[model samples]
Target: MEDGFNIGDIVLSKMGRDSGRHYIVVSTDENYVFICDGDYHKVAKPKKKKMKHVEATGSRSEYVAGKIAEEAKTTNTELRRAIAEFEGTENVPVQQDEM
Candidate 1:
């Protein structure tokens, strides 16, 4: 596993109010990182969390990295989709009610 996290890295919150939640690295500083889930924490309002509070999931989103590298605008839908894809839940069919 990588020792450090970079932009677009997927991480799981190990400690804090958002513990046990998954987030993507939106930005980072020397000791803190900005994370978002595209739901509670949107890209526009990424939560600033200590680096030690999150555990790297060892999975990364190249699509997100490319967008960040290109300085392109990202949306919450995209973030949610990326997370679902990474977790292998994107293809699961939603159950529909029989009316």
Candidate 2:
């Protein structure tokens, strides 16, 4: 299909006994994909068509990325606060070199 998976994406199978199984995409050529479904005891191999229907598992990585972004925001804010306190002023003077 035109919407087949790309490399490095995680997916969950939606049919057969493999239903609800999670897999990681290893590679793809045309209509099939090489995948590793850890929970299903499947190692890296290209699966057959229609036997494995998968949906992308992007939410897991997205949630982790969002957490990292939040942490970065908190760290940036704290650094600004620390600089302000060290300089004994709420606003620090900007340097032309820094700009």
Candidate 3:
């Protein structure tokens, strides 16, 4: 069960009522990952999902990643925009760092 999940990475739910819904990876553990959509799943209360239950989308958010790596603060609005930017559903610009 190689999760291959990283903070700020985008993922898709594979096995649950939320299946097909895209979310952002906020945190991870040995066996599970915490995700937030910034709506139903807020950063204040992310959803804990099994690693195998999610499929990595190969997309990442540098802004959120930077905050986590720096131990700085991350907000739900940022998360929501990140998701929207990835899904191309919104025109909100996501600040991404070139790493």
| Per-candidate local distance difference test | 0.84, 0.46, 0.86
Q: lDDT: which candidate is best?
A: 3
Ranking by lDDT: 3, 1, 2
Question: In candidate 1, residue 52 scores what lDDT?
Answer: 88
Compared with the true structure, what per-residue lDDT tens digits does model 1 show for residues 16-98?
Answer: 78899889999988889899878788888999998988999889989987898899988777778778787888875433222
Which run of 10 residues does model 3 get worst, by summed lDDT? 90-99
RMSD of 1: 5.5
Score candidate 3 by TM-score against the native: 0.86
lDDT per residue for candidate 2 within 1-99, as digits (tens), equals 336566545566776676775555545666665555322333322454342477776522332224334643222233233334333554764322211
RMSD of each: 5.5, 17.7, 5.7
At residue 24, what lDDT does model 3 achieve? 90
Give the lDDT of residue 32 in candidate 3: 96
User: Judged by lDDT against the true structure, how good is candidate 1?
Assistant: 0.84
